[model samples]
Structures are given as structure tokens and as C-alpha cells.
Target chain A: MASSKDVIHSKLWQEESEPGDPFTATACYCSGYDVYGELLHKASYVDYLYLLFRRERPLPHVARALEILTIALGNPGPRDPSVHAAMSAGVGGSPAAAALMAALAAGAGSSGGAREVLLAMEVWTRCGCDLNAWQTAIASPPVATRQLVWPDIDHFPGFSPYARDVSIPVRQTLEALADCLPDGCARWLLDHRQAIENLVGLSLAMPGVAAAALIDMGITPEAGEMLTLLLRLPGAAAHALEQGEMGFRRFPFFSLDISNDPGPAMPKEGTAR
Target chain B: MNERPPLETFEGSLNTTMGGCFPGERAVFRGHDLHAELSDSDWIDLYVFGITGRRHTPSQLKVLHAIWVNTSYPDPRLWNNRVAALAGSARSTGILGISAALATSEAAIYGRQIDIAIADFLVRARRAIESGRPLSEVVGEELRTRRSIGGYGRPVAKSAADERNAVVLAIAKKEDLVGGGYLKLAFEIEEFLLSGRWRMRMNYAAIAAALALDIGFSPREYYLYLLPAFLAGMPPCFIEASTRPEQATFPLRCSSLIYEGPARRAW
Candidate 1:
């Protein structure tokens, strides 16, 4: 019953840690140990989760506490010197170690594993970790494909998925990695015409790499439709929309002209309701 | 253990059951018809509290489709024939019909009503989004036409009152809720409304299973709350409306790690 803010402030989320450790606190705001378990579970939780990128035994809960700190410091992916240094500090890699490695990798920049972090964030939303960090981490200049230890941004054009400073990297990561996403990544580059049209017309505007990546993929026929609409609108209106000040009034007229009946798209047929 | 005798076996079926206004007249299935009427999505928003309007299995979806196709009625008994067949099927198939009937027939009935009454009002809003229409035009049109159904009507956490209820609305209010997180919200809401919560409703044992899709509860971990919730609360209102005490009191028990406790609702 506590407000999200109150719940966030509760002791349930507190984790004492060493000064230089990476942050591993559960972002969903579940019990502390459980969050560690989710990151290191032997089953699909570990295998599929972006956090456990490498194979290892679970880290001591104490060391894992660094995850919260590290993430707070800025999403440390595999490339992050600090995260790699933390991984090296562990004696024998445990599941927690593996999760730290993966979490680090996800932040390492536009890697598929990074996308997996987005998925983990979505699944573990209750944790209430800071999301903005994840966006910044994922948006960090990506590493290219050939050198790819995992799927990094350098490999995927315009593929930044998380918005910097949104919430917690864990939350954003999970949402990005949700089930039934395109190309197995939470945010995919639209590489298709219809999709691009949707974006241009502003029918399809997602956040982060998903939006930019989609545009990078290619301008599709859908993009053309959206472009057509944008062009037809008064120049001021188009600028307003681009400036994030667009409203929702003329949608029906444009839709009606484009499709005659905004039937399926409108939800209710015959009229706009 | 609240198992009760079936309504048909009850000495006075009509005496035990209360008839509310039929679909098309009032909101019967809690907020199903109302929610569907408001949006153009393919899915129905079902609010199943206890055993009365529980989740439907795959086969039950078919039965629900059957009942929905069967009739539009003021008499609740109109569902009896369908329910009897469903109960008989459940004996073998292990999935009941009542849930399906309620989900489909009731959704269709109410969706039509709300859509009919509010279609014009929605058009201008849609146009505004599509055509890059001025905010003034959209608001003015909605106001001039007296078409705004202002209250989001969904109960949210009291603390988060300033937060918009729906992702679409949040998108419209992009400045207040900027960035990828906004898209993430939309995706989460869409998933909850379409699949995850929908499946949870079908399983019927989770605490979240008893609540509406729009109502937020941690999905998997919420099982810890089921037993206590059932023990503390009344059965779903619709079940109380149609079935007898004996039949209505189906004991809520499961071998899974069930947590018997109070369900936290935003309302």
C-alpha cells in the first residue's frame, strides 16, 4: 500500500557494501536475497537473464551487494573497466559473479547481452532500481559485431534501447527484454519500410535505440505514409510534433483520409469512440 | 474450505440468485464491458475476484465463444443452459464454461454499448493524433461536443494520483513522462492487458488472478497472498449473483506455495 516512493525508501531495499564494489541490489524491490537469486538461479533465470553472461558459481551476497552500487555509479557493462575489475576481484566465479559479469556486459554497450539486461529489468520491475543509469549504459557508444563477445551496439546500427535516466537499469533492462520482442532484443532497429513509415507519421515512436535503430534500419513505406502526413500538416504543426509538443486532434482526419475508415486502428468502428 | 452445493440443486435457485440489469443496460461483468467499450483493443478486461468469475481454460474459451454467440438477454438464466453444458464438460475437460461465457458474451454486449454511445467523441482525438491537429482543436472539439468521459475510472494507488492511468494517455502527456521509459510503460501495460495477466486470470490460484488486469500486483510472487485473500473476502460478486451457497463456496486450496493473506488493492 505504500506509494512507490515510500516503498523505494523502505529498508527492504537497503544493502551495505564496500566503497569500490559494483551495485547488485534487486531493482524490482523484492527481498534482497531473492533479487540475487533471480540474477543467479541455476535454471532459465540465470541462463536467459542478461545479468548472468558468464558461467560461474553465485557470488557471496556481500560481494553481490556491490551490484547496486556499481549500477548506481553508472551501468557497468563488460567493457567497463570498473566492472571487469570487480569481476576479477572475485575469487572463484559464483552465480552472483556471473550475473555481475553479465550485468557488466549488458552495460558494455549495444550488445545482445545488453538487450538481455533490458529484459531482466522488465521482469524484475518491482525492485525499483534507477532506470536512467541503464539507458545511459546501453546508449554508451556500442562495440562493433566482429569483436562481439556478445551483441553490442557497435554491431547494431541505431540500436540504443534504453533511455538514459529513466528509472533503474534493471527495470529498463527487463522491459527491453520482455517476451515476444523483435530480434530477441527489447529494442530493435526498424529496418523495415512500413515500420519506418509508422515512425515518421509518428504512429510508431518508441524510446532509445528502438526508435533510432528503427530509423537507421531503413525508411519503409509506412515511414513514407507518416512522412506524407507530416509533410501535409502545416509546417508549424510538424515542427511542434518534432519538438515534442504535438497534440492528438487531427489524427482522425489524417487516418480517415489515409484509410477511409480508421476501423481496426480506432478500436471502435463507425465513429472515433 | 468454502465449497457449496450447486445452484441447480439449491431448493430455491431464483431466491438465492439476484438479477441485476441485463448487459446493454448496466455494467454486469464488473468493468469488462465498460473497459472494452472504452478502447478498440481485441482483448477484454476481465475482473475475476473469487470462484464465481474465475479464469477460463482453452476449451472454456470455446464455450465462452459459444455463450457469447448464443444470446443477448435481460435474464441471467439465459446462461444456465450454457453453464450446465460447461459444467458437464469441466467434469471431463477440467475447464469450466462460466468464466468464458462471462468474458466473451458480457464483453461483446458492453463493448457495443459503450462504443455506440462514445464513438464520435473519440474520433476527434484520433484525428488529432493522426493529423497533427492542434491541441485546441482536439480539446475544443471534445468540449464542444461534450464528449469527454473525464475520469479514467480505474482505481490506482492513491499516492500516484498525478500519474496517468493508461500508457496511451501517458504517451499523450509525454512531457511529464518522457523518454524510453514511457515506451516501456506502454509495452508493459500492453503485455499485462493482453497476455500475462490474462493467463494469470485463467490459472485462477494467484492473488493477482482474483483482481482486474489493470489492478497491479506482482505476478508470480503474488501467490503468497491467495489463501488469506480468499479466506478474508467474499466470492466474486457475479458468482454470488448466479450460484447457490453450496456451489459458490468452492474451497480455494492448492499444493503450490500459496500465501494466504490480505490482497493489497489500490482502491
Candidate 2:
């Protein structure tokens, strides 16, 4: 007998009944909740998303806060590299999933990326809302770990040194989310928003804000990373799909500095090079 | 509904000295004709140029090519390649299969992360050396933190030796490309390990990173350039698995899963 080489384990999820019977799932439990039978009609999608990670249905305010942040991060638009990655696949007629994969890969870095959110969430774990602690940590950032492929944080992951002025939407979203979850870290972030912004010479980017929101919700950094990626996905998916139909002609191609090779110097036919 | 982002949010023309398409006319890549002038150029040359904006000599390009070639392990049991095989097994689109495979290539224990770690270690080592820190002390600090250096150890079931290192270094030697700063330091670390308590040999990624550092790939550039290093092996895995049967890529019997967690119960 060949001994079992791999074993699948999960406390977060399980499904009863095999597929292809009249009722494929007799029941599906998510962290002990009867997902389809009991919680299907009762729970909101955000609540369900919360249960998937946090393993419990959230309080109403927490659900609302997640929804607010979700709406804020839904679509980062075309110029955002994550969205642009998806659009590249769309324009090139590549497979649909490539666009999102491109988004995830491009968004894995520090500049408004998921890893930045992960780092920010880790920061939240270290220093909750203490201005002095934030300052000390920022001034003497820890040496980056070697296990990850992402680059070292040049600036604090949450704060962007390049942002000149805090934009309207970022501030609005922060205030809205903070209002919803007043007792959580979001409020702490809200209270100290300007002070930290002044200290860093700029406000929190979306990832930083999202990190604070996740922390306030009692979400772990690991869970926060997933949520940040999940929340930001709407834009990447929507733009990639839209760009897929627009094709390359109607899009911005050499609008500046028109050249011979939209690929100008074709060798009668393009061969390999 | 939400308000639009500020006008100057990502302002500035998306200009590039890199590549751009002219639509129907021609494509520009690093100030050269994509088709007309550089049609005879090897693909790897064009790729390396795209990364660093500097053309490499044929000798350099050959070693770079070998670095990619030796990594084309078609076995589906490997982590990243399994995604491709499974994608094909499910009859998924090539784009999804390849993209998912590439995405999963950012492994913690191996692959691109290892390259990134090696490059980063080399950089930090150089800086510490420049700042008058002894080489051994820096290595000691890193070893103490990370347990072992990133590219020096492997999951040595059969032998601790890295088989691919010989082939790649041979190409580097054949091309007279062995003499590079980071490469020398990489070997020094390996030598240090050999003499010390942790007797680990240099793996392929360590040398590749050293060569990349010598060949003038800034850590970020090297990171970008090596993103698709395992790309060549994916498509074949996808095709082979897909052509066979649905759900047939390495079929495990249902009983193969030994769930040690909780007993099956109703929700």
C-alpha cells in the first residue's frame, strides 16, 4: 500500500455530501455557521467575507466599515499599475485571468501594493496609535526580511513620501470608514491621521488606510493582506474586461511622439527578434 | 457613488525611452527598430536590453540564456509548474494556466524570492563591506537571523550538492564571464560555509544573482527581468496534462486524503 503523502486540513471550511446529487451540498459550514442553509439569506456578502477569514459573522458596523472600504478601493482606475496590468492583457487579447494575475503580481510591491498593506498591518500590530512609537519606528525602520521577494520599504509602507497633498477621496473615505467603526483602530487612525501625515510629510495611501481599517476590525495581518487584495480586485477586473473590448486602436497608442513602428520598422514580416 | 480621483493624481505623460507601439507602423524598443534593424538579434538579447537598456555581448547573453535553460524542469511535482499542469488538466485557457503558474512562482522557499534574497544579500554585504564591516560578521548576523543564507542551501534529499550549478558555471566559464564582483563574493560565502559549521554549497540562484549584479542589473531591474524565468516550461506541462484526460494530471484516490483535524459532522 502506498502511504498517504499529502493530507488536506481545514478548520475554516468543510462541505457535506458529494457533488452531482440532486442537492450537491447538503450543507456547507464556514467556521461552524451553516453557510447555505442558515446564513445564506441572512448574511450580507461582506459579512460572509468576514466569516471566511475571521471565522465569525461580524457586527453590523464592521460589515458597514468593510463595505465602505470596499467601495473606496473598488476601482483604482487605468493609471494604477494593478489595473493597467489587467488592461494590458485585455488589449492584447490574452486570457481573462491573466489580467487579474497581472494585477496581483504588479500589486505585490511596496508602492500602494498588497505587501505594503501587509507591512502596514504588521506596523499596526507593533504600534497601535502612539505618535511617538510611530515616529520612532518610522525613523528607525526594521531591516527587511530576506524570505520575501518584494523590495525593502524606502519609506514607511503606509505613508507615501511622494504624495504632495492628501487627495479629497482618500480623506473622505478615511472619515467615512472611521465614522462607521468609531471604537476600532479606524478611529484611532482617524484621530491621529493629520499628526502622522504631518510627521511623514504626507497622508496615508490607500494601503495604509486599508491596513488601519483591517486592524480596527480585529483582522490579523495575514487576513488583512487577503482582504486588501480582494477589495482592490474590482478595479483590475472591470478595467481589464473593458479594455479587452476597446482593442488597441481606440486606446492611447503613441498619442505623443508618433513613430514609424506602431512597430515602424517591420522586416516585411516580424520574425522572432 | 464615489467621486473621481484628483486630476493630478497620476499626472504626467506616460512617456518611455523603453518600448512603445506605433500601432500599424512599427514598435520601438530601447531606441532600436523592433523588426527592421534588430530582426536578426536573439530574443534573449532583446529581453536583457529591455531590462537594463544596455546590450550584452554574445558571450554574456549565452550564459544568461543557460541560466534560463537549466531551470526548465518539466516535472509537474514542482510547485509552480504544477499550477500549469493542473490548469491544463482542467482544460483551462493557456493565459490562466501560464499566469497562475507565474504568479505562484514567487515561492518563499525557492524560485524568484530566492533570487531576490540573493541579490539583496549581495547588496547589503557590499554596503556593510564599504562601511568597514567584516564580511564574516555580516554573514554571521544574516545566518543568525535567517537560519541559513537563501541561495546556499537546498532541500537535499539525495545530495547537498546543486547539480545545475556546474552546468551554469561551466557556461559562465566558457564565456569568460566568471570574473564579476558579486559572483566572487558569492563564492567566498560558499567557501566560508564550507569551512564553517554550516557546510552548504552555492546554489544556481546565488550565482545567477551574482552574475546579474555583475552584469549591471540593479536589484529592481533584476527582479523585473527574472519574473518570467520559468515561463518556457509551463506551456508544455499545460499541454501534456490537458491532452490526456479530464482530472487526470496526477490523480490521487479519495482515500489518499487523511484528514486528521475534526471528525465529519453536520453544520
Candidate 3:
């Protein structure tokens, strides 16, 4: 049992009591911008993010790759759990913050979100960056029959309903991004696209490409999910706001049977436990 | 093979005071063999023991369970429950819907954070009173720093009589757990706060915090322990809503929205 004093002082990061204002700094400004005091005016948001995470400016190709990945996964449509949760919250007349919170929670799951990408990244690492080894392992006897044996690990993060037939522009953008980057995970993914598709029986999803790009850029698996969350936030906000504005409470197309008993019965007043 | 990180550089140890499970063999809970030694134990008892690394008497467990049961409202109007219902209405998967609801349930105003704050306050206040500071002065100092105490106020309603609070208090009294210093001080603070025009009453968060603090659970432990309390009733809401016509739970119309923005313009 830690005493109150011990608990309070044991925090890992304690801000200095007399630290100067955060907005205006003498040395390095926001996200390591110290050159000529003019980094903010010139750098793009992705460049700033790159500096913030990696503590250095991104290569042009790296910046472009991040931009492409971010745009590719910007909107997963209303069917995605996060977007649907946001719209549902909006339809219920919840405030914007509440809707956003619901969306974030939905997006934090192991399926159809960043957690899936994290799992895929873990599998990639576990396979020692060898696609052949991964394919062999998944294709072997006992594991092959299970299909989804590993806990919390999605064997294919990029397999989506639309994977079989990706839009031409999206494919072209991915191909273009692949051409600009070094021969790392992203390039490997592009190079072995058909093989991966044949093995998984689905085309690569944008999230899989994003995960490879993130790993190539030196982002860890844990941080990858957070980056994915940040990327999806704007799209979530948009869906929530749109639902709050233009949508009705009842989604027009969906249909199901309403339950008579919605929840557990509350203990009657004055009843003994 | 990938090179493993140096073991000497690790910040922590391999041993955990918490429980662990072996795939098909056994589970060790709080240093005890769960299967052999504690198989007959109550689920809530095992849960508390696993979390706090301390065992509670049956009376204490009863009171704790009662606190959770009392706060588990089945009504979907609550914030977390609303999230669950909305998830169902949107036809999302069970895990996504429930996780979303649980995540939103950690809100500052009406959720686990408030309970954590309350527990932290009670622990500090108890220590202050033990150190010779008067209860009123300590409470007044706290109020001076923050406008309203976390556990004391009921924002939506004005009544002091809450059914859940009454049930929790009754259980505490029956279990002989009501005489603790923190509980006493909580009552004193409630009296002091209600002395003037302020209509704030001691709600479930305050009572639960005081009880938990008295039972030797720290503020952080109290927060983690109480995670499943409100969670128990949330799933049924999601389950029920999923069975209903999609987007039917608390359905609204576009006309219901009050737009205060500029006149519609082309993009």
C-alpha cells in the first residue's frame, strides 16, 4: 500500500513548476522546429507529425507515403463500426463529444480497426519479414485448418469485402507510392501483391498497406494503432457531424426485430437483497 | 531469428502478484491455486482477490457486490447504456458495440473517473483528519481548490434520497462496515456541503469511494475494481437493441435537429 505522498510523487513525468509558456520557446519550437524559426510556415502537417514521432523531418517519399496511406483509410464508409457507432450516437441526439467517444471506442477493437493492423504487424515481425515463411507457416497442416487460430492476431489485416476489386485510382495511387519508396515492407507488399492475394484469397486492404508503410517508417506496432486512430478521427468527426445534421433517428434501410425486454430487471424499491 | 532484447535492460521482473492462466493445466490466482484451493470460492470474491491481492470476508464481499448491483441501472437512458443501444441500432458487432460503450463509460462527469477522484479525495481527507486537521476545514480546503467535490453532487436531480445510495448504506450498516473513519468523514463533508444554499447530496460515487477506501483499496485500485460494476447491465441493452429494427432505439428525425448555422451554401 503506497502512502498518499508516495503515490503523488511517484509519477513518471512531473512538469517543472516554473516551466515557461509552451507556445513560445527559445530553443526548439513545436515538434523540433529550430531552423531559422520558420519551420511552421513551411512544413506540412504530415511533416510536423513525422518530426514529432521520429524526432526528425521525413524524406519526401516517406511524407508522400504517409499522405497516401492517410487518404486511403480516411473513410471506411458508414458500415465500419466506428463510423456506424458515431452515426448511431448522432441519431440518438448525443452531443458531438459523446458521438466521437463512441466512435473511438468502436475503432479500438481487434477487428476492422487499428488493433487488426497491430496484429498484422506483429505477425510480420514474427515471420522475420519473410513472406514465404509466413505463407508456409499459415499454410501448414494444423494451423491451416483453424483459419484464425492465433488470439488477437488477424492473419490478414488488409482483407476487406472490397479487396477483390479495389478501385483503379486507389490501386494506381498505391502503386505510385510503392514506386517512390525504398525496398522495405511497403515495397515487399507491392512486389508480392498477387502472391499475398492468392494465399489469402483477398486483395490487400488499405490498412495492410498503411501498416507496412508505418513499419517501414520505423513506427512500432503499439504506436501504429494510435497513428491509425489519429488518421481516422477526422473521418469519424465528419460522419458524426453529418449524421447529426442530415440524418434521421431511424436509419432508413436497416431492419431487425425489437426485443421486448431490453435489460435486466432492476430490484424493486424496498425489496431486501 | 530476431535478436532478443537484453534481459538486464528490462525495467520489471517476470514474477507477478496477479493471477495467470495455463492453457489446459491450471490457473494461479493471488498466489493460490485457483482450481485446487479456491474452486468453491465466489466469482466476485475471486475477482476482488485477483485484483487487490487481498482476500475479503464474505460480509465485505456482500456489501461490495451490493454496491455494484445497486448502481447497475438497466435503463438505456444513461450515457454508457445509450452508447450500447446506439451501437446495436447501427447493427455493429457485439464486441465493437460493447467496447464502445465501455470506453465512453470512462467519462469524467458520470463514470469511473468520478469514482476514482472520489476515492482519491477520501484517502487524502482521511489522512488529513488523522493528522489533526478538522474535517470541515479539510473539506473546505478541497472545495476551495475545486468547486464541487466529485462524489457529493447530483447534477440532474435535486433530491438527497437515492435508492442506490440507501441500499448501499443499508448493506454497509448490516455488514458493520459503516463506522470507518473515511465513511464518517464523508458524512461530515456531506453535512458541511449541504449547510448553505447548495443542494448537493452524497451520491453513489462518494459512498462507494468511502467504502472502498476504508477497505484498504487505493484510489487507483478503486477505479479498476469498479470498471465492471456499471458494465454488467450494459450488455443487455446492446443485446436487446440488436434484436430490434436497426436505428429504432431512440430514433430521431432530421426535423428534430435545431440548426443555428448560416443559410445553406453550395460546396
The digit string of per-residue lDDT tens for model 1 on A16-80 reads: 33344323322221223334445345323312221222112223331232222223233233233
* lDDT of candidate 3 over A204-225, digit per residue (tens): 6666676777888878888888
Q: Tens digit of lDDT per residue, candidate 2, span B1-267?
A: 113355465455554566676667776777777777778889888887887888988888888888888888887878899999999998898778878898788887788888788888898898888799988899999999887787887864322778788899898998888898888899988988888988778887788888878877887777777887898998899989989988878765434443344443333
Output the worst ten-in-a-row residue range by lDDT, candidate 2 chain A.
A258-267
Least accurate 10 contiguous residues by lDDT in model 3 chain B = B258-267
DockQ of each: 0.02, 0.27, 0.02
Candidate 1 per-residue lDDT over residues B1-267, each given as its tens digit: 113343355333223121122334332232234333433332221321212333433332332222222222323333322443333333311122333333232121222222222222233344455578754455445445543322111122222322212322332234332233322322333334335222211111111121211222222212222212211111132334344443332221111112222232110
lDDT of 3 at B234: 85
Off by over 4 Å in 1: A1-165, A169-273, B1-88, B92-96, B106-267
By lDDT, the best candidate is 2
Model 2 regions more than 4 Å off: A1-3, A16-27, A91-93, A141-148, A152-156, A159-165, A242-250, A257-273, B1-13, B126-134, B156-159, B179-181, B214-216, B251-267
Q: lDDT tens digits, residues B1-267, model 3?
A: 113344354434344555566546666666566677778989888888777878889888988898889888767878888888888888876666777677677776777767877887888888888899998788888788777787887766655555588889889899999988788878888888788566678888898888888888887777777878887888899889989998878753322233332332211
Q: What is the C-alpha RMSD of each candidate to the true structure, in Å?
A: 28.1, 5.3, 19.4
Ten contiguous residues minimizing lDDT sum, candidate 3 chain A? A141-150
Give the best candidate by DockQ: 2
Docking class of 3: incorrect
Model 2 DockQ (Cα-based): 0.27
Q: Alpha carbon lDDT of residue B63, candidate 2? A: 82
Please write out the lDDT profile of model 2 over residues A68-94, one tens digit for every residue: 988998888898888888898788987
lDDT of 3 at A246: 76
